[model samples]
Structures are given as structure tokens and as C-alpha cells.
Target: MTAARVGVVTFPGTLDDQDAARAVRLAGGEAVPLWHADHDLKGVDAVFLPGGFSYGDYLRCGAISRFAPLMDELIPAARAGLPVLGTCNGFQILCEAHLLPGALTRNASLHYVCRDQRVAVESASTAWTGDFTVGQEIVLPVKHGEGRYVASEETLDALEANGQIVFRYAGGNPNGAMRDIAGISNEAGNVVGLMPHPEHAVEDLVGAPSTDGRGFFTSILSKLVNA
Candidate 1:
């Protein structure tokens, strides 16, 4: 009856590692600190890549961090169904790592946006979103400059066919993401990436009074317990 152990990876320039770990703990899981340079996963049940400007956003948003030593282990583990969740810059890293398909590009408006966004859960079968119901709308904070999602038409069709599209902007497409996509999961539904910071919305005393983000952490813990 031990708590589920969730690893929160911290890449250089990562700004949300502590917040992500706090979310894990608030969800009743044990948060394991993981470094970008570490080659091992430390036996955690699942891994989370928090939002940040890794590698100082050099080259591209997540280009450099994708090759981090820890990613060497993470990539394989995620592919093998280890359950991975990436938010914001972490989402960019997931795409760069090819853990999830599609890519996050510069916002269509060419402006950095930071706000509480309403998104609908398009697919809840993913490990990180199982607690949510399909089409349920929730509010999460999004802060990023390159948050627009782009993919080929064929890829978009396939993602739709496979139910890989996880979340979509509810009211309007803030960043002009293709098809209003805000988040998506891999084919196996074990790995997910999103351009919003769910960790930032988990506490009521913080900026927003909504705790909608807590489900992301709890959902994974539930999946681990059931496994």
C-alpha cells in the first residue's frame, strides 16, 4: 500500500520541476526527483517532464533537451508503456524526442501568451487523463511562445482515426493550433503531451481558484494502482 512513485525530470533551465513534483505529492504520490543528466529512472512507476525553457531555448524550444542523457532512458521507457506526461516546454521535448507525433511551432500571433485556458478532454483513455470524461471542459494555465501545434493532413487524420487527440481548446483556438488541438497522446495512450501547465492550476490558493489540474496527477496514480 505504498504511494505511487512518480519521477519529475528536471532539465537545465527547467522552471516547473518543483511545481510538478508538488502536484505529484498533492495527488498522493511519491515524487522522485530526476535529473536531466541522470541515466537511470530510479525505479519510479511513471515519469513527468515539466514545462521549462530547457537549454535556454537554444536551437529550438526543446531541441537540445531531447538529447539529454536522461532522455536516453526516458524515450525507451515511454515507448515500452512506462506512462509519461509532458506539459508546455516538456510537450515540445516530447515531440522532439518523437515520443508523441506532431510538433509545436511558434504561435500564429507571434506573441507569448500566458493565461488560464479552457480545454475539452477529447480523449480520456491516456494514462495521464483517465480521470476525465470525454468532452469534459477544464481550465488549465498555458504559458508559452511556441505553443501552436502543427502536423501534416495525413498525420492529423491518423491521429483522429486512432483517437490520439486528447485535448482541444474549448472556446477558441488561442494559439491557432491545427484543429484546435491543445494536447495529444501516443498510439498506445501511455504517453501524453500538452501545451498547458496543469500543475499551475492544481492549487486554489495560487493564481486561479480552480483545481482542475489535479486530475492529471491523480489519473496516473490510479492507472499505476490498477496496473
Candidate 2:
């Protein structure tokens, strides 16, 4: 099978670009490196916005990266049904770019948090989450200072009504996100944003041995293959 070319975009301050690329390779996809400043998406089958304090998180996390030249193409591609995954700070960029709804804010405790967290798959229909059954639990490393997800009550209700909530923190909430939400997908299921670093958990030797994060990459690959 020809591997799907998955683009891992690197912004000015991106910290997880290489890890994200490795994850894509582990998932049997061709990992394509992309630059934030580039206007082209390189004709990749999928895109991943890795985590980091882009633009030094000036004013806000992902606030500046949203204006990068790549985003001009990415935003339209995402809206046109291209698959895009955003992790942690990347999630912030998606929200800032308006690709995904809701806003990520400082942790209620105002602390930079790092831990292995569990999240339940609330919906399996998205392009990035089809590998897990609904309600499946996955453990992954989460390290961030501002990971709390918030939205207006009306938007919250709409997300629930439309079944857009893709993942919810299990057991206990780590960041005080509304409803313990850890991830979400757009109505089209092509775009997803989450706060956990699934790319970091793909291997057993370096990080968690549970292999919870591998499914994230595999799921997306499977979806692309089957499509």
C-alpha cells in the first residue's frame, strides 16, 4: 500500500514537530515536513499542527500562528474537508484560527500541568478517531500551562447536541475544562483538536507502555486507507 502523506507543520516555536512526524511514520504513513511560513500544503493527504508556544504565545497561545501564511491555505482546506489534527498548543491554534470552536484558557489552578491522563472516546466517527470504539479509554502524556477548554453555554449545548465532543477526560478532570472535555471534532469530522500529546505515547520504551496514543495515528491512517 502506498503510505498516505501526512504533513507535520512546524511553526516558529513548535516543540513537537519531529515527534509528530515520527508518530505518522509509526502509523505507516509518509511523514511530510511542512513549514508554517510556506503557502503550500505540499499536497499531503493529512495535516498535523504540533504543539508548542508558537510566537512565544504572545498575547495568547496560537494567537499569532493563526496568521502564518500556511494557515491561509490550511483554514480553507480544513473547511473543504481535509483532515487536520491539532494537539495541545496546536489545538489552541485551531481554535484561534476558528477551525474548531471553543477557547483554551489558563488552568483553573493556574499551574503548568504535566501528567499521563486518560480520556474517553465520546465519538468515533471523526477522521482521526475511528480506530477506537466509542467510550474507549486512552492514556497519553499531557503537558501544558493553558489547557482549559471553555465555550459559551449555547455553544456548549450545540456541541453536545451535534455530538461534536470527541474526547472527555476520564476519572478526574486535570484542567477544569468545561465538562472535562479533552478533545473535539468539527461537524464534518475532518478536523480535530485535543490537548493531550498522543504522538509522545506511541512507543513503549520511551514513554507510556500502554500504546494508547498509537491508535490516534493508526485511526487516521485507517480512515485514509479505507476512504
Candidate 3:
């Protein structure tokens, strides 16, 4: 079988591109590097927008990145059912692009947070979470100053009703995000965005005791293979 090719996008100030690519490779997939200024996607099977302070987080996180040339191609592809996973600032970008609902704002304490966070998988049917079981608990690192997820009441209701709320912070709400939403997926379930850094936790040798993050990459591989 041919290895599924997953693209890891690198925008200026993107800190986690290499890690995301490595995660893909470790998951038995080919990792394709993508640049924010580039307009092409290299025909990859899936796309990952890793955590970062793109454009230096100047005009709000992911505000400028939403207009990157790379997004022009990515947005359409995602809407057309290409699997897309956005982590941390990437999560902010998805919302800025309107591909995913809600916005990430400053942490309620107005401080940067870095910790291993516990999250419950609320929806395992999405492309990036198929390896997880619904109600499963996993630990992933969360590092960001603006990771608070917020949305309109109507949107939150719709997400809950449609099972689009993919992950919720467990134990405690680290960012004070509304309803403890750590991650969410689109109505079609192909596009997902989250504040946790799964790529950073893919390997046990990297100081992450658990390889819970590997599932995100492997889940996509399974989806591609099955499709």
C-alpha cells in the first residue's frame, strides 16, 4: 500500500511544523512540507496546520495567517472534504478562515499557559480522531497565551447537537474556554481544530510519557486507507 501523504504547513513563526511532520512520518505516512506563501498543496492526502505564532501574532492570533496564499488552496480543499487538523494557533486560523466555528481569545488569567492537559474525546468519528474512542481520556500539552475558545450561544448549541464538539478539557478547564471545549470539528467532520499540541506528544522519548498524540496521525492514515 502506498503511504498516505500528509502536508505540514509552515508559516513564518510556525514553531511546530517539523514536529508535526515527524509525527506523520512516525505514523507510517509520508510527510510533505508546505509553506504559507506557496499556493500549492503538493496533492497531499491530508493537511496539518501546526501550532505557532504566525505573523508574530500581530493582529490577533491567526488573523493574518487566515489570508495566507496557502490557505486559499487549503480552504477549498478542506471544504471539498480534504482532512484538515489545526492545532493551537492553527486552531485560531481555522476559525479566522471561518472553516471552523468560534474564536480563540486571551486566556482568562491573561497569561501564557504551558502544561499537560487532560481532555475527553467527545467525538471520535472525525478524520483526525478515528483512533480514539468516544469518552476516552488523553493527555496532551497545551502551550499558548490565547487559547480560550468562544462562540455564540447558538453556534455552541448547534455544535453540541450535531456532535461537532470533539474534545473537552477534563479535570480542569485550563484556558477558561466556554464549556471547556478544547477542540471541535466541522459539521462534515473532515475539518478539526484544537488548542492542544498533539504533535509534540507523539513520542515517549520526547519527554511525553504517553504517546496519545500518535493517534491523531494514525487516525488520518486509516481514513485515507479506508477511503
Candidate 4:
């Protein structure tokens, strides 16, 4: 059978596109390279927005990248259940596109943070997290200056009630995100965005801190295979 094809998007300054693609490949899927300027999705099974300073971060995080030509096609596809995932700056773009809720602001410390972060899976029902179980803690790398997630109290409560909250900081709140939210899914659970870089932790041979991140790719591949 043909392997699941996952699209890894590259915006200008997108530093993690290759890493994300490698994770998909390692998870037994085919990684398809996508450019920000491309107007089509190339018929991939799922889409991944990798982390980086898109548009030089001239505007607030993903504000500019939100208008990328590719996003014009992506937004609707994601809404139609294409299964999309994002990390760090990719998470910011997902919010700007309104594909996911909440916004990532500057870390409370007012400094960039880079470290191995332990995140507990709060909801494994989403496409990208199905391999995990509730309360399972996985370590992934996080590197960002603006990583604090903020949303309205009502929104947070609703997310909690609907099981849309995906991951939460395990050891401690790394960025003062509301309710310690590290990641979340949309109402339908097809789209997900997180502050940590799962792509960075999928390989341990290169001295990566953990191989836990590989599950994100595998989870989505499983979903595609069964769909």
C-alpha cells in the first residue's frame, strides 16, 4: 500500500520544516514538501506547520504568515477535517488563522526559553495525539521567546468541558499559560497546535532527549490509514 503522505510546510525562515518531515518519514509516512507561496496542498493526507520566524516575525508571530498564499487553501481544508498540526510559531499561525483558539504571547520571564519540557497528555482523542493516553507525560523540546498561551476564562472552561485541551505542562508551568495549557485542539479535534517541538524529540540516536515525539506523526498516520 502507498504510505500516508504528510505535507510539511515551509514559510520563509521556517527552521523546522525538515525536522518535521523527518519525523513523518520515521513514522512510516511520506513527507511532502510544501512552500508558503504554493496555492495548493498537493493532495496530501495531512498538513504540518513547522516552527520558525515566518515573515521574519516582523508582525506578531504568525500575523503575516496568516495571509500566506498556501494558507488560503489550508484554512478551508483544515476545517473540512484534513488533520493539521503546528508547533511554536506554527501554533501562533494556527491561532491567527482562527483554526485554533487562544494566542501565544511573550513568556512571562521576558526571555527566550529552550529546554526539554515534560507535557502531560490531557486529551488523546485528537488526530495528532491518539497514540498517547490521558495523563501520560512525554518530554519534548520547547524553544521560544513568546510561548505563553492566553485565552478567555469562558473559552478555557469550554475547552475543558469539551475535552479540547490536549497537553498541559507536567513539572510546572513553563510560560504561565492559562491552566498550564501546553497544547489544544479545535472543537472538532482535527486541528491541533502546541508550544513544544515534537519534531525535535522523535529521534534519540542523535542525542535527542526523548523519542516520545514520534507518536504525533504515527498517530496521524494511523488515523489516515484507518480513514
Each model's backbone clash number? 0, 0, 0, 0
lDDT of 4 at 119: 97
Cα lDDT of all candidates, in order? 0.94, 0.93, 0.95, 0.93
Number of residue pairs clashing in candidate 4, backbone atoms closer than 3 angstroms, sequence gap of 3 or more or interchain:
0
Put down candidate 1 lDDT per residue, 91-164, tens digits, no spaces: 99999999988899999999999888999999988899989999799999989999999999999999999999
Best by lDDT: 3
RMSD of each: 0.8, 0.8, 0.7, 0.8
In candidate 3, list every pair of residues with a backbone clash: none
lDDT of 4 at 62: 96
Model 4 local distance difference test score: 0.93
Error of model 1, residue 117, in angstroms = 0.4
Off by over 4 Å in 3: none
Give candidate 1's TM-score.
Answer: 0.98
- All candidates in order of lDDT, best leading: 3, 1, 4, 2
What lDDT, from 0 to 1, does candidate 2 have? 0.93
Clashing pairs in 4: none
